[model samples]
Target: MRYEEELIDEVREKNDIVDVISSYVSLKKRGSNYVGLCPFHNEKTPSFSVSRDKQMYYCFGCGQGGNVYTFLMEYNRLSFVEALQELAKRAGVELPEREQTAEEKQQADARLTLRDMNKEAAVYFHYLLKSKRGTQALVYLKDRGLSDEMINQFGLGYADIYRDDLYQYLKAKGFSDYQMKESSLVNIDTVKGNYDKFFNRVIFPIMDINQRVIGFGGRVMGEGEPKYLNSRETILFDKGRNLYGLNYAKRSRSKSLILCEGYMDVISLHQAGFTNAVAPLGTAFTPNQAMLLKRYTNEVILSFDSDGAGVKAALRALPILRENGLRGRVLSMKPYKDPDELIKAEGQEGYQKRIEEAESGRMFELLVLYGQYNQQDPESRTEFIHEIAKKLAQIEEPLERQTYLASAANRFMIRKNDLENLVNRYGLGYQYEKVNEQYKTPPETEERRQEKKKSNKNQPQRLLLTWLVEHPEMYQYIRAYIGADDFIEPLYHSVAIMLFEQLDNEEKINPAAILSRFTDAEEQKEIAAIFNTHLKYGLSSEDEDKALSDVVRKVKLASIEDEMVHTSDIVRWQELLSLKNKMQKFSISRS
Candidate 1:
């Protein structure tokens, strides 16, 4: 309704849901619907079902369902406006410019202003990188094997030795102290006032997937307390949620990403023609980062430092990758400490060969565990063999697990049958543990969004609304006894009112458009479930009438009971008692 309803319909009509989702997920035709693995969660089985007829998708496993716009917004982590713009462009439907309200305009302007400040700051820093003040920084970068082209490509720059350089520059450009502080480019020190956060460092402007400069990473030019510093979490950026060089790396035609440890690693890899490389912004890998990566690529190649800490980092990252259904591999940069050193010694062809030869994540883990134990020692070797079996048990697929079982036995020169017995023993325990975990209660946040409150009253309200959606022609018959107000649950009542209004006006109900009415992602999903709940198929006409009659009575009786609890008027109370009696005989027919 914000834009004309027709405009949204036009956009939706132009871009078919199946066509749009197919680009992201590999869906197979199954009856009238397509099914695939749910991208929102890590599931081996395909439970994500898309309906071509309804122009909607629902994941039976995760229960995340919605129309095409919601699919794009959820999968790409885009805002509704951003999703609209993206779909509009793809559909070739030029959206008419719509005016923003005062409050909305203010918020939009603030975000725009911050991005503008960051852009201006990038230009200024890039200018200074070429200026005399950046001589030392530029020399250091060049010495590190970074070309001038790479420097320009990454928008690499320098923060002058002056503490207030960027602060002064931003202030001169008419940015307020509040804006400067909010941008995270300047720190507020009561003693020093506003000062640049990245002084005496080489700067790397961190861009989002949209190529907007939201934050910055600055490595100290010389020895300092912290060698590298990143902009703190701000309205514009969260380090855990964004990856460095992702703006360019995401465009790589490859289905995988080369994940590195630092900005230089990503830059060097990009410069060496591995433009798919990206790195966390001076933080350990996070689940949010994993989900973000999942949106872009199915696999990630871990290119970490070859030092002990690097090995530890890789160990830490593998499980998170597995949890998100990402196929992780370790880059075998053995002779070199990191990707930079490897690339410097061997170049792109060697790196490409290494990438092709990257080990599977489980194998990498086994190798790391192998390094910890001395195979020459009898006790250490026995423990290492047990560890391999335990890890192999964790692999849920029998074909994959059995293949690893043989590989581990041959690779370690252990008896295949002996190892197989230990794996089977561990696999049983793992299976038991997994089954137990499934029965444990979900977190409260998930409960709130997925299933708000399930009760006897809730079920009837939910079913009645769903009934109206699937059989709108039945609304006229059902309206004689129960109305939208009788569907007491707030969300259900709101939806019922809309359904009735649309029906009264003689317009076909658009469930997807109704979903557009709720902007909050959680509410949209909850609303989607009202229509998405599977109705019993192949019902006898008599059975259908009985089901509808029963649902209507239940909803009406519950609504009356709820009203009786709150009513203060004696006359209204008397009417409610009489209405309660009238409700007991309430029944409707298909005719």
Candidate 2:
């Protein structure tokens, strides 16, 4: 649910972004905006820029950018509503209660129905675990070192061997087969008739961060092909988007999350008092999962299995973690397959010791890559070094890159300068092409090239919108020829609609308030980048005029070409061609 735009804007107006951000981050004014080391990622230099003029913040290093609500959501792991409530309270403003729209209300009702069904199903499963029919299943859990209290805490249960047991129970409780199927608790087949989804398996209820049961996972008590079966995607569940024990892990005071490989591993860790442990839903770690982790903590330690598959999974997860602005570490559970095995061999203290000595995300990747090649052989070692250089090049911040590069050089007995050169060579080749395309002049210095790497038809639109944001006075002349429809780029087009509306009404253009209109983080980030786009300045007025003209012409040409592609009518094509040629001669008016 979203608050009304007027109410959101009022709250935002009271809580200045710079003032609010200053309480959390030590920001010092540099030029027109505030500059500080980005709190989202580790950096020696201050790459995070906060603009009071626009009321937005962006990490030039990590690409995390947004308005005030976004800042709270990312920095403190609060949801949009949560952030809104906090800001409203802090500013001593009252948020007005509002009713949901017809569509929103209907959607809400459906979600509520699903939640109620999942909750009822969870209760039934938990009750069965303590019943006479669940004796063998209970015995299996007990043998696996699960106490009655732990079982109760996790809402663990068992499905009887009878296929129709749960189906009948749910049906008697007034939940239709359609609802049951939607909840993924029961399946109705024409040939096999209706039956339970899980039979003769230990059930683990997968709850959301609110501790509401959204889905379930069942591990087979005896021999089975899958061995572990998780609830399929339903209205209430998306395995890729949700983690198994986040409800508990989010509350852990620890600053890091311990990511395990499976349900048993997560439960075992929780039982052993590592309350911050979580796991993916029976799949490889995903970018979404890492971003989810980013909300709770900046660090996530990978506690995957130590076998070949586990090593591969860890390697796969590390880059995703780094990309999502997390400081990922990898722990070794050697001589033991998993955390559960390790807890049995050595106690909680030993596990803590292993965690303390976990390898840094970079070191782990480097060491794994190093192990893959014969270090003593020159050709293999050179290949290994190049791989190392490529990985180093991916780190956008030079200081951080140099720090890791020097460490890699020292570890491998290579010269720091040589490794640094290899990294820069790889980094610059790609950066030059991308940055060169965005700007007319070749990036003469590192700072110029590091502004941004965007290249596409959208770049001009992004550039023009950014220009309007920084210099809205130009809209008096710019609007005569260009309009929202001319943006062509979908996101830019949407922003331009609002921007042009505000400009037309002669309202003060507040980029921050405009940013608050977007709800999704990715949308807000792109919107922020639009407001904060780095427009390279030319040396003279003539140069600046020429650059602006080029951007306007590019934007107009792209829109014309786009219209011609969709229109089959010869008249429309001819009109588009005439406009394209006219736009080529379009000049800025001073009036």
Candidate 3:
């Protein structure tokens, strides 16, 4: 019913899945299917397959498969609607306007309002920083040794100490008080009911990956209890997810990512030509942030404040980096309180030397340092060892664990044997392995598990689908014997059913025809990923068909077993009653 759905269907109807994917992959026609290397994961052999009659794709190596929409979602990392719109544009399908629900309309309106407010706030603060009102802030930055270029690159700004200044500015610009409050740009007094949270402070805009200003952090210029104020959580941003200067860092280099503790540190470092640097926005490093870093580079350098708190944060972050498969090192600078000061006091050269000379301390050493600094004694040591052991256990490599065990033993002055034994006692490795195994089956408790399972189970069927789309002539031999209903898994079954019904109804097969019928955005993406996986790795046709048949049979048997279990529960009582009645009849007849 939607425009993208219709457009996708048209594209699928006109184009052959194999031919479309062939543009991306080098495919060879092997009887009924095509085979290629899988694009999802790094593999040498060709396990990806496409079926001309099925209009689907499957990657046997990685078990990735779906339709054209799924292909785009995985390859391009585009959302469902975005992928649909893109594919539609490619296929020359004109789409109609979509109807928005009431909730959708409201959310859209709120987002627009928040975006406008953030832009206005950013502009106002930047203007203040340049004007006479911001003389103190300018002097503050100058004293901190930040260059004009650095300030501009970071879009640093200032907010005056006037009550309701931001409120008034936004109000005149047509933003309501409610919008300002919701935007987190200004705060309302719980007691007085109206106030600005960021008065008399230098403001720093928090940006997302797309460089959209999502939130702000304000440093109090004068003597204040807190000294810093950050924007509350909003729709566009979470303090944990948005890293400072990552948008800039990701663009410059891909070799190494520098994780700093503060925005000023990142800005100053970037100005010093250390461009690959970013910091979490007013929060500790999170797993999401760690995963984000992994995408850009496996090598990471953690540079926190030289204070105890900074060291502790680095220690906490070590296991996270390790867990995410990041090659990370901790840089312990002079106890100069903060990174901005050290960089300012000692020029880039000095900081660079310190960074290079930094000792590569394992996570356990950092934790020991943390414990020592915090003065955690006897009882705390017990809790501490358990914590550190758990963190160490997350390291999946046996060699890596042994390496860290030595480090832990040396730092704690305990025997290497005792420490190694303690680390093993925690069972962190076993827990991680269990979790890893659970992940292989697509997590049963996950809300989307059914879809994930179907995707996983129907990889071979997807290959057939892709081949059918690319080589429709192959459909004749398989059409009568196979239909969508034959597939046990929904993804394969659904695609099969769609193809069978379409060809049966229309008396012809077209890969692009039913794309529009895939209205679910998530499913569309799954299909795109599936297709992209196959196309990225070209495969031969015959092998694809054989793989599909084998998987289909396995899935059907599993489905039958599942049904038998369910039916057995229902018939259990009837069997018991029948046996009892037979015994009674036998006894009565004998008497």
lDDT of 1 by residue, 1-591 (tens): 257777887898788899988776767788888987677776655678887766788886777988999998777665666688899999898987877766667767888998999999999999999999999999999999999899998999999999898998898999998888888999877886777889999999999999999999898987896899889987678787789988998889988998999999998999889999999998888766887788888999999999989988999888877766689999888889999899888988899999999999999999888989999999999999999999999998889999988998898899999999999999999889876754564467855665555744488888877777778888888777878898888888888888888878878777776776677777777777777787897998878888888888889999998999999999999999999999788776665
Local accuracy of candidate 3 as per-residue lDDT tens digits, 1-591: 344444556655665577666544545666678876555654434567877766777775555776676666555554556566676677777667887666657766887788778988999999999999999999999887889988887889999989788888888999877777788876767688677778899999988778888889999988985677789887666775568898899997447788988878888788888899899877778765776786688778888887768877987787666655577777767667666777777878877877776656465354554455433576666666666666666566799888877787687666777667777877656676655753353235665676568667566567666656555655655565445655655765676777777666655665434543565655554564544444323545655555444543444445444445556565764654554444233210101
**Which rank order by TM-score, best down to worst?**
1, 2, 3
Instruction: Return the candidate ranking by lDDT, descending.
Output: 1, 2, 3
- Residue 547, candidate 2: alpha-carbon lDDT: 78
RMSD of each: 5.1, 8.4, 12.2
Local accuracy by lDDT, each model: 0.85, 0.84, 0.69
lDDT of 2 at 483: 91
- lDDT digits (tens) for residues 1-591 of candidate 2: 457788888888888999988766657777899976577766545678998878889986667999889998876555567688899999999877766667657666777888888888788888888999888889988998987778989999888899999889888888887777777888888888998989888889999888999888998988996898999987568777689999999999998999999888888999999999999998777666776787788899999999999999998888777755689899989989999989999999989999999999888999999999998899999999999998888787878888899899999888999998899899987577545643444335666555444445368999898888877887887777889999886778889999999899988888887788777788888888777778886546666667788888899888888889999999989988988889999877452
Worst 10 residues of 3 by lDDT: 582-591
Residue 21, model 2: Cα distance from true site in angstroms: 12
Candidate 1 lDDT score relative to the true structure: 0.85
| TM-score attained by model 2 | 0.69
